[model samples]
Target: MSRRILRGFSRDEFVSCRERAGFPSRADLARAADISVGAVYAWETGSATPQVDTLLKVAAVMGVSISDLVVVAENDRHLGDLRVFAGLTQPQLAKAVGMSTTALGALERAEVARLRPDVAAKLAEALDRTVGEIEAAYERTRKRPPGVAS
Candidate 1:
């Protein structure tokens, strides 16, 4: 599938944050982030979005939260957005929370009518959201049209 930047990941914000964090160059940020400079360039240029793992490292090095790197409104966030905010790949998160990637994807796409309470608890813990927030996001996802994103 295509690698679209999760909604709310601002390249300009990333650049500004990097600068504010005192990294004078992408190479410097890369070194601090323990990733390739090319990756930084790619993300900045919108040629590619950074992986969750890479973004996680970069966020740590820059002393910013993942949400700082990718800004989403609290109420607007959905399951997919929660995953991204946690800096986890779908597979990674699925594995952590003991769900199939397909199932997670389905939830993200609002393929189901409602989230199971147990599943919601798992997702909440994994994504660092409250159960109510998870349910609310799921509701938002359900209300949104398919092919849309948060």
Candidate 2:
């Protein structure tokens, strides 16, 4: 049977939080939440949206509320939210992604800077997001209003 794709919390957002939270694998998440690995993968990939009970379990593991996990709109992109939902301190995420906490802070705060390709890849892997997602986030940072402090 084909899986349904729902329009709620973005799969990318879910994946990013899972990675940042240091979930070793989908199986690990499944074990933690008492769900199937396939279900976890499907949820992370947008193939399937979890039911309320499962969503609650996932939120509990990720340290976020159901509202925080839902991505109702395109502009709902917030890396900080993902970081916080993952229950990771900036330093922890920075160390995982092989970047200095200062640089990570700049990225989080939208202090735009050209990222090295390798670093970008590392960030993508560590965040469980595509490189394009990271690039886009940084690009948005660059286009922020001039009066805004990065």
lDDT of candidate model 1 versus the reference: 0.84
| Model 1: CA > 4 A from native | 1-4
* TM-score against truth, every candidate: 0.87, 0.47
- RMSD of every candidate to native, in Å, equals 2.1, 12.9
- TM-score computed on alpha carbons, candidate 1: 0.87
Model 2, 37-137: lDDT tens per residue?
99988777777777544676787897767666665433544444345434455677789987788878777666655766787688778767778877665
RMSD of 1: 2.1
Best candidate, lDDT-wise?
1
True-structure lDDT of candidate 2: 0.66
| CA lDDT, candidate 1, residue 148 | 76
lDDT of each: 0.84, 0.66
Clashing pairs in 1: none
